[model samples]
Target: MTIDLINDMIPPLKITDDATKALIWMEELRLHALPVIKDKKFLGFLTEEMIMDHNTVDAKAGDFLLKGENCFVFEYQHTYEAVKKATDFDFECVVILNDDNEYLGVVVLSDALSIFSQSASIQSEGGVIVLSLNQSDYSLSEISRLIESNEAQVMGSSLNIDKNEPTKFRLTLKINKIDLTHVIATLERFGYKVVAKYQEVKSISNEKERLDMLMRYLDA
Candidate 1:
């Protein structure tokens, strides 16, 4: 899925402008990191840990913040890349900038995770469809065709070879907006053996009784 870049945006400013105020600003924003820019050019991020590492309030603003040209990404770049890029520099957030190095925004790791959580997950909506078939029977192109036939796009998928036997494999697909009955039919018609389904089975419990039980359970 393509990530929306507009969700990631943070202001840029120099650390030396007011270092103490920056710390308070970060705390107020609930951020552990922030972007540092000079003359509209991207600089490295200033992190809470880095500030604490100095262990000296006597140090000037420049001394406490990250320096040099190592951190920062081209502003229009993909938002999915924040995790990898952040890991490379041990940065809590990566500063994003334009072609001319003008301030664009900053992508906090937490912000990206928030976006991830809010997005639809297949497990929460559609049930998983697993098929036991010969390894040779599987083809990405054909599978894509079958999935589209039911007007559903594959959201996530995984495959595993039978450990006890060779040439037999299991393919698991997560489809979008499909009823379990239809999903089983499409796979079964294609000569795939439906192995297991993990849908939320309807409970026979009454709604009021279920709630009372759950509340008692939580209380216990």
Candidate 2:
């Protein structure tokens, strides 16, 4: 859960704190923005730019109009939910609150992305298959069965509406095996439209190895 990724190192701004104090904290912490709270409840985010624009050495934190007041997620929510909220609000971090709506901590964008890169689907050796399907024809269970019959498994999958064709959608499946020839043929035999396929390198040994493989892939 996202609660596990909460970053408690960055302290929140107190409503009574002045702009001078906020600016100092921002510089020391190396963050562009910090959350403001009153009585353990989140108010909003205060940015360095907001403070600098005011040009007040002693302006109270409460005097500024903070941003991302509604940009938050409960601690029990999924990590992807935090990512989605950050994307929707265009905030660098997402505030986390408990069931009582009290501030818990914030999840920085970099940490969240790091967790995703280490996920099984992204790190494991695999091949990606992109299929074009009608909205009504989409069914993961059916697709998985077909892939399984070909001695392969769907490690992960994502769906998106085709912008060029509103009536159709694109399904991207990440297979655990590097060779997708059998899987692609099985899907096509089962009336699935195989639009594209790409093979991936085997499981990486370490961060440096993973990065080296990525660089080589990019160069290719």
Q: Residue 80 of model 2: what lDDT?
A: 66
| Positional deviation of residue 132's Cα in model 2 after best superposition, in angstroms | 8.5
Residue 37, model 2: lDDT of 96
lDDT of 2 at 145: 94
Candidate 2 has a TM-score of: 0.71
lDDT value, candidate 1, whole model? 0.59
Q: Report lDDT (Cα) of residue 187, candidate 2.
A: 89
- What does the lDDT read for residue 29 in candidate 1? 76
Identify the candidate with maximal TM-score.
Answer: 2
Which pairs of residues clash in candidate 2, taking residues 3 or more apart in a chain or in different chains? none
Write the residue-wise lDDT of candidate 2 on 114-177 in tens digits: 7656868767888888888999999999999999998888887767676567799888787888
- Candidate 1 TM-score over all chains jointly: 0.51
Model 1, span 36-127: residue lDDT tens: 77777766666667667866544545555465255666755655455446655666666666778776666665565555444344223555
Global lDDT of each model?
A: 0.59, 0.82
